[model samples]
Target: MMNNKISVREVLVEDAKALLQIIPIIDKETEFTLRGEGEFRLSLHEEESFIRNILAEPRSVMFVASCNDNIVGSLGFRGNNLTRYKHTGEFGMGILKQYWGQGIGTMLIEHLLSWSEAHDIRKINLKVVETNIRAIKLYERFGFEIEGVQKNEVKIADQYYNLLSMGKFI
Candidate 1:
């Protein structure tokens, strides 16, 4: 349920091409959200490979927000593993330029939390840009607490930006 327009559903393997159309939108967000981060902007081929990888992983999931069957946004959750931390998960979500400021992101997070709980995942974590105050606030609303900070963690173009680690427990 989002803006009474968008619908969230499991991402399909064939959706790789459709998802590619949203690349420019994600790129713009990454410019700010992942600035000073040595992040790789995925090419179509690379993204397709990633889609395949996600599809193959049983403990990972991908969801997309669609309106009239057109992809508008996406979110993903992957189970974390470090032997002692097998009950944890990491999540990420993104909305298209036109869809930002809507309630989609929060709704997506809600869905993910519910999904995680049902799957027996006890904790969920996310790394956000320190400058992304709006996002940080939203996550707080959902009960995520600031766990710590990784200062100058991302080297974007020429600068290193700080990252805030946030987590929520079920």
Candidate 2:
């Protein structure tokens, strides 16, 4: 078990470098994410710009989890500014392999929920690979319902996998 307390906070421009390092590591550790190993190639300047943009958008937010001052997880929500879609947003998250089962995911979700409620977000959505049962269960536990499935949404190693679209209304 991890003895260090994990802290989750909004991403800062200064985190760009650390994010560049950790994101690809997480990608390499899990097939559940869309990007494969060594596929995350955001340059430091691009990452900093992205962070600035996210911060400037009132309906969008990104959070990072740190333990012992090291970033180990990240979560982000992106919402549309259009009137028709302003109340809903989609979120994505990732955690380092060593930090799995350490409640970091739970903290991130809780923070997102609180932030969504305060920001007038009515619904939250996420997509997960169908075979990722652990993630599916976690979403379900948080009251997200599987709204639909996309067949063969992802191809890996010459095999196809389905994707589950899940949502929760705040």
Candidate 3:
């Protein structure tokens, strides 16, 4: 019952509106999490600039998942800047709240994996909040391992949280 009708494609500058819908989803989801406390608020202008930066970089790529003409998720990978780590790329992803748990995140990660291989990105890494078990498990299923914990890393709402760094080799 899987449908390829849900399309994943490179994100374009014109997709601002479609992608904007997911920002609130991210905000609300992370609001209760350690990163969303009173600090690190997401801004439309910042996100817009981020999209442009990723698109402008030569060794970076961004992708969006769309269904029935609406974007439901987005992901990206940026090549490591240091020459010694050039084969490695950092990655991240987010899905609209309504579309989560329906395999959108899974498919998005899978698609990114293939894209990484094609672009010679040999490794991918990201950091997740230690309390987010679901996301940690999802990354585990994709062959990512817990690299380490960043102690007292993020201060959210008057509390501190650890960031569990995770990574995978393509």
Q: TM-score for all predictions? A: 0.84, 0.98, 0.83
**Candidate 1 local lDDT, residue 126:** 92
Candidate whose TM-score is highest: 2
Instruction: Kindly list the per-residue Cα lDDT of model 3 for residues 1-115, writing each as its tens digit.
Output: 2553577888887787666766566656764233342344446677678789988886788889988778877887888768888788877777766676788778888888888
Q: Which residue ranges in model 1 land beyond 4 Å of their true spot? A: 1-4, 33-46, 156-159
Scored against the true structure, residue 109 in model 3 reaches a CA lDDT of: 88
Could you tell me which 10 consecutive residues in candidate 2 have the lowest summed lDDT? 1-10
Q: Could you report the Cα RMSD, in angstroms, for every candidate shown?
A: 3.1, 0.8, 3.1
| Stronger candidate by TM-score (1 vs 2) | 2
Which number leads on lDDT? 2
Q: Mind giving the per-residue lDDT tens digits that candidate 2 earns over 1-170?
A: 54797899999999999999999989988999989888888899999999999999999999999998899999999998999999999999999999998888989999999999999999999999999998898889899999999999998779999999999999
Ranking by TM-score: 2, 1, 3
